[model samples]
Target: MKGIILTSHGTYASGLYQTVKMIAGDFPNIKIVEFHEGDNLENFDQKLIEAYNDLTYKDIVVITDLAGGTPFNRSVMSLADKGNVAFLSGANFAMVYQALSSEIEDLSEFVADVLEKGKSSITKFDMEEDDEESLEDGI
Candidate 1:
């Protein structure tokens, strides 16, 4: 089995999780750890450890908001020894949605697809660059 762990500097993790739940409903395999203001690194690390321990999946993926931020750094340092776990930073709705919705078996393939879809979802809609005559035309 595979699972997802979402951690961020503040409520971003929980907020994003809630948004995903609204669209995709609840998924039992997903866990969220939030690092709020005034929270110490030790506490946050402990909470992350608990979250990881709670998951029964053999393979886990930890997603964080920023690459060099506390959440990401802590996860890497703490879980680096875990062979079946992977880490991804700068997570967005598209990445999480693809992760929770997909039924893929291979962890590498799953992560690759999530990265591809997530990156592709980011687009700039410039009227001038896109050669759109008017905003109303796009609508």
Candidate 2:
């Protein structure tokens, strides 16, 4: 079976991680690691490496918080010529869910589809506030 690594900006908040875990529930063997905690890039990198080494099987996917940031960049560093690993930043629970539950056996196809889905999932939501709309109501 494939393994999953859910990493964020830093070490994940326990509550948020649990929520993601709850939503991602059902994978027989998926692992998660958070990378950013109080700007501790060193710890994040180490934990990410450890998680990668431990959970990797025939296929492994790493979900990062952002594409060019320390978490993603450092995780990419672990790839020194290794190709069995797949990395995804700009991640969300939906993408991880898809990766965890995919039915395809071919790693390439699975990774391809998952990456497409992940990239497609990012959207331009309107964060700019309107004078009339409340933040709660997306005004």
Candidate 3:
């Protein structure tokens, strides 16, 4: 089994978790850590430790809202020596979904797949008018 940890500033982690749950139902070994206003690095460390300890999976994937932010930096430091852990920044629903649902045994491969999926999922939606205009122009 694998696990997922979502960490972010403010409520992004929690909100993203809820959205994932709404779409995919409750999953095992999934956790969220929110870094609220006035929260210190120690606070984030504690929360992350708690979440990491609670997971039953050997391979854990941690997703953060921003790269080089407090949550992301602390997570990187905390899991630095942990070979079973992988870190991903700029988390979104698609990445979370893929992480939770994937049954891939290889941690590196799984992380790579999720990263590719996450990146590919992001796109600009064109309005109908613009789409039609582009189609008419043979785009």
The positional error of residue 123 in candidate 3, measured at the CA in angstroms, is 1.3
**How far does residue 117 in candidate 1 sit from its true spot (Å)?**
1.2
Q: Give Cα-based local distance difference scores for all models.
A: 0.87, 0.68, 0.87
lDDT of 2 by residue, 38-58 (tens): 766677667767776777477
Q: Which residues of candidate 3, in runs, are more than 4 Å off? A: 128-139
Model 1: per-residue Cα lDDT over 22-108, one tens digit each:
877898989999888889889888888888899998789999999999899999888878888889988999998888777888999
CA RMSD per model (angstroms):
3.1, 5.6, 4.8
Model 2: which residue pairs collide?
9-36, 10-35, 10-36, 11-36, 133-139
Deviation from native of the Cα of residue 88 in model 2, angstroms: 1.3
| TM-score of candidate 2 relative to the true fold | 0.68
After TM-score superposition, the amount by which residue 13's alpha carbon in candidate 3 deviates from its true location, in angstroms, is: 0.7
Error of 2 at 106 (Å): 2.2
Off by over 4 Å in 1: 127-139
Model 2 weakest 10-residue run by lDDT: 130-139
Q: Estimate each model's TM-score.
A: 0.87, 0.68, 0.88
**Backbone-clash count (model 3):** 0
Residue 131's lDDT within candidate 3 is 62
